[model samples]
Target: MRRVSIFVLCTAFLALTLSTGCGGGGEEGPPDSGTPYVPPVPDAGPPDAGPKPDAGPLDLAPPVVLSHSPEANATGVPPESFIEVNFSEAMQTSRGTLQIIPGDGLPNNGLLVARPEYWDVTRRTVRFSFPLGLPLRAFLTVNLANFADVAGNVTQGFRTFAFTVSDGVAPSVSSTSPSEGASSVPLSTSEIVINFNQPMDTSVGTLVPGGGLSLGTPSWTGNQALRAPITSTLVNNGLYSVRLENFRNINVKAMDGAPYLGDGKLDFGTGPDTIAPTVREASPVEGATNQQYESTRFVVFTFSEPMDTNLGMAELVDGSTRTPLATSFSGDGFTVTCDAQFKLRPGATLRVELTGFKDRAGNALVTTPFLGSNGALDFTMAPDTVKPYVTQTNVPEGATDVYPVEVFSSAGNPGYRKVFTFRFSEPMDPSVTLVTLHDAQLPSSFRNLAGVWSPDRLTMTLTISPPSSGLPPIEADKLQYLELNRLKDATGNLLDTTIPPLGDGRLNFRTLLNQRELNHACEHAETQGPLLVTATSSVTAGTPRSDVLHGLYELTLPGSGNTFSGYTRAQLITNQTQPIFMNGAPELTVTDPASPQTGIGVTLLPVPPACPSITHEARFGTVASPLNLRFSHGQQRLRIVLEDTY
Candidate 1:
């Protein structure tokens, strides 16, 4: 069995030697064409070293600041200079943090934070910039932290740098309540407010007022504003001045900070009015009697100066009752009118009391309640039962040669014909007061009259027009009469017709004659002598005598027949010069009788004589006399003397 095993091992060895080559160096030949050759693969040591995934290198170094402007511990740095920081290596640009804090060690103090504004293309350099400069004279600290590298390595701790900004400017005034050179400032300004451009040190500064101005202690607000109270009353229309001295900023420096050198003086002016107002005059004057108690009646007060209408109040007191009156001011503020809102008692004495009145310049009235006899405005109210009567009229009782139309184009009404105006003693009711015009040539039933009342209903203007039918136009050279019948006052009082002449509501007047007759009469009177005419009655005509009356003829008036107290004279001179007299008898002159002829009229020179003056002229017979001296129309030969008092 051993010999057979040896033979098997020799056979294996001989096969291996035939497949492997010997150690001798020799070139190999090509393999047989029947089989293909295969190449061997190289061995790798571990699975981890064969074709691993790509990942960046692990870095743990933090970023550092390379350089910074306004270096640490720097002084005298300009406030307008910008702060800059440069990083040493590339950083996580968005993750960096920087802080500039005030070095006062106070919490809640203002601070500045740095933000990166630029980065290089290589991502290795980062810079921070400040656009708006820093605060003046500020001690600031720059802190750097939270800066990370691209590999996620943050800064370990904070890096701090300290510096200071320089300042050479002084504080200045920004504004004032009443600016410099201001005018019309109120005299009641209680305080003055001052604003500064920078925070100030109020402990060391002083504010002084001049020009008779007084001020109290000043207080500071927010280190930039000061308020000073007024210590005394300011004068009206006065000038004042103020000044600031030794004013400095809160930031103290060596040898004391430089003081403000700008304009330190402030000037202003006050208002221009100060006089108090007083009552100058009043209507329905004090102690007045017969004052009508009607709606149109107003109690008016005139002031010495313009008043402040909004500030005053007035009231009307009647016996024990007090009532508020509606007050209104005139456009000029010089007159105040009071109207009663309630009905006033008849025959009662009333008083108007004023209070709290002031002028435009804030001056109170000199005398309260308008100082009077009893310290109030007093007037007696007229009884309502008093009858209304004619106070005056445009056409008197014996007015002659009066124009038919008083005003032709009145109030833009070209056709409005006003012949007569009748004024009443009190406001009358137009509904009850009736006016009629009666023509001597027209029938009694022919009524052709229209009337218009004044705004206060106290006067009536009569206009005459032809009737719509049957009546002819108003004829000239005829007698026209006006009758006011059934007249009543505003309070229903009947008219009092017991008075003389027009008091009975009757007025008689003669119209002018034709132009031809008037011309003929005027020619005849110019050639005729100054004839002697008789005076029969005060308001009537008398026949003429044959004797020529020349020179001055004096006539004494009786006391019981007239309101005159002196004698009157008639001067009938044709071509003589006037005679001047001194305190002699009142005289009437008749020299030129041809001109201004009305209905065959004779012109009387100085027609109305002056006695105790013209207001109290002597009458020939009665109160209503001497209206005109003329002759009857169409009767040139027959001369007559007519009344000539108006």
Candidate 2:
């Protein structure tokens, strides 16, 4: 047919050029149809295989955080701490994650997850378990987020860290109040305390006032005690010392906060009273004469033992010029005064003298040529025509509650403010009675101030500030008549707006919330009998009414770290709000008992309004039972049925 189809296409193209071998020189291509053609090699299939292209997507890399363990800020650490971390590869233990964060004294807020107690088999370390042990002085932190890595790559961590724990136990001074070589210790021995051996850190522990001794405000009674007090200048029997100074800022740390490593000092003495404060009673009684010009004068001295209110004074001569006196002292430092600017000439004669005194043991009064005969006086005057009048007052005119205890026992409890005097019968004219003695209800720019007058000007006092810590059932409403009405009288007249108290002078009174809690339990009674205690519960029946609800009885003696000297019913009710009824033997005096009959009593009852009820009571006495009973915040639960002492 076309030559038999070209001989079957030339025998299938010569069987595809004899299985695809195109020769060059010995060419058989196309049957040499062209003599130089060589083309048949197409069977290279099976050797080319088929599966190999993904080495491209399996390599990741992000998992770091290869080490950890209480190593960050470290520090003592022993309340039972445990933290470990380590992870650079393994990890993916279900995605991992952890968090801790607490800073001071810790309470809760810590999270964790990595299961299997998070062991270390390529699960990449972990291990955190504080259960209930990490809190004494805490700091913590430790984060470690997300975590991954089984090629899921994550965790590239540093995570976060910090650590503290502390049990290295350091804070010392287990006891001391006047002990170490203690002698008579009384310049009125205010306080000393100290205790410690643990539980401190309310600010590091500081007492200071060293060698010559001074200290005044240093507080803290429970977490191991502290107290302080002293300062009214102390001295008296002299030879003091007092230190402590540890501070990381309050430093005295212990409960694990550590600190209080050095300075504790101590040493005491004072109780010889060497007798040197004369003037044991003065006030125009040393020479006596006519007296009475415009009255309102004052001189008072009475000091047989404690004085040195920075060396007192009081002058009014007529032949040596000297006038600088503004005194005030009587919280039992033994009276002093001077008052009444001294302006009386009438028949003329005057003398009065007295000078720079001293006592608290340093002794020294006869200053220059004055105090020689126990101090001078002389007097004479007597002309004044009579116009003043308001007689005595500190809170009387119809008294009701009353007990501002002279503004918190002379500078304590809200302390300082609460003045309120008013004597006047004459001596008027402190520029017109400090601008017309006021408090009419207050604000005429609020006047009413004219203290220090009685050396025979006939009296004229009038003060009036009050209110920082006294009126809560504590009293002071009726000042009823401390009035003055533009005052006058040094010889100018005026004052007597028709009497009834210079014209209305109202001073209504009303505070005695239990008479300053019975004068703070009769000034802290202590019939003597071993003493050392501790009690706490500031307000926990419902929580909230704190005019100082009494939570710490703390007297220190029942064993651990003793020492806790006088004054503490919260330093005698600070910023008080009444409600007191204390008792513990002569004001808690243990002197150094520590055992025997160890008793400490306290009672605060008067928080009745609606919030948390409140009515406290506490008694401690037990060297094997002198009668130990304890109760708190009223609900009425006194059983009483003992009988097991055989």
Candidate 3:
């Protein structure tokens, strides 16, 4: 058998070798003798193709903004400059929202209606154009959102920026002294003054003189005014002309870097000033009564012609004592104002005397004493004893149940009229009468109070407004007070607080309580009980029931009951077992079912009482007993007894 197998294997090996070596198509192969045979490995689908031909890296990052025109917070940008934005990558043009919002001062103060003009060839930049151009000197904001790349990645980074447009109005001259075609201008005028409509760049511009006129070095006072002094004496009855060349404002420039427009030539005729300056008007006219006596008081003298301010001397005289005044001249040299070095005595006749004064042409005054006959600039100072005081008020002292209709109300309400009117004994100085309104209950509570003086300056109408943030309002059910500090009259006399009624310059009044405020007070009286309740009777027929009920009573108002039930603390001492029911209206009423006499009938005068006198009545058998009720501390302490009729 072995021999036979060996022969068969030899024959198969030979056949496989011939077929595999000679390229014959045959599959005769076997392992040696007893070895195991294995099948050929399956194909791995074309050898993996070398990592699938490399598709490149993933695009997971967001797109970025590369740059923008009219850079962030850039000022003085041309109004017509196109706005452009460049992105780091090509972006989708139709996928974003662009808005241009004006910060201020434009017909369209809100969002500007504009659209992108076009995207560049690379699709990375976009430009926007406004047909009418942006408003001059306006602040604007450019906002962008949802700008995505072609790869579906939204843009990341700053999406909004602000810029300011340039001022476009050219500089021009508003006015000039010795105006165009002016005649009889003073030959002694020291300078040619030019006033610009706006501030100018003083570094540039020249004042060219003509008509035999020569100008000295020019000087500027606050860039808005230019002064060119005359170096040579001007000729009398001569014509003059001056041209302002290359003058421009600090912001005047065109987009092409061109200079802005400026004022043209100014021409005038000069005439000799032969007339002497004389006092034409005086602040305190001769024989004037009741002038201010304070040191800050000014005695002014207006001259008929411009004067040489440097050559002037004046004095204020009271009797034989004379004092020099600190004097200053008006800009045009047409008025001389004198300030007193010391406070003038009250109730004195004062006179202002000008000894030596000259006009611009060195002409002396015709008369030495310039104002009145013998220069009697005489005026009487107000007497210090004649002080201002509150004569009357629209709201009376200790007034109760007063409505704050005019004092405090919502806007547009007819009740929004003056709340208080204070009539003074004399005309008071409105500037120094610092009258303020405050809350009596809240010591630190002050209102936004304003006052309007009558035409005569004797009466003031007060209006109260809401206080600043975090402060309470002057609402209903409040005790308001008025305070006058540093209130003075025109003569600098202080307010007299020793007057009747408002003795301390203060007036207290109570506002009427609304339904909500009354309910709140009732709730507080209920929860925080033991309010003092004192009572007495006026019936003299039998045993006079004086102090009928005087004790701390626990109050209870159950479930919207406008009536209060009082439980006395000392029930045995009072010998009162039945509960006393008290009505909680403006006219309160008290009753007890167990009592034979009609229980105390309390009538609150003026509703919400502010130290108000109340009327009370009690009945026993056929006699009617009159009583008086008083509320001391709001509704905390109450008394019902016989005192005044009302």
C-alpha TM-scores of all predictions: 0.29, 0.27, 0.26
Across 159-261, the per-residue lDDT of candidate 2 in tens digits comes to 7978777754555666677776677876666788867676656666466665577777888876667786776566545677665655321232333222332
Ranking by TM-score: 1, 2, 3
Worst 10 residues of 1 by lDDT: 608-617
Q: Candidate 1: lDDT over CA atoms?
A: 0.58
lDDT of 1 by residue, 431-474 (tens): 76467677755638435465778877888887665343322234
Pairs that collide in candidate 3 are 628-641
Q: What's the true lDDT of residue 106 in model 3?
A: 36
Instruction: Mark the regions of model 3 whose C-alpha exceeds 4 Å error after superposition.
Output: 1-98, 102-131, 135-139, 144-158, 162-169, 178-180, 201-203, 217-219, 253-263, 272-646
Residue-level error in angstroms, candidate 2, position 248: 11
Rank by lDDT, descending? 3, 1, 2
RMSD of 3: 31.3
Among the numbered candidates, top TM-score falls to: 1
Say which candidate scores most in lDDT. 3
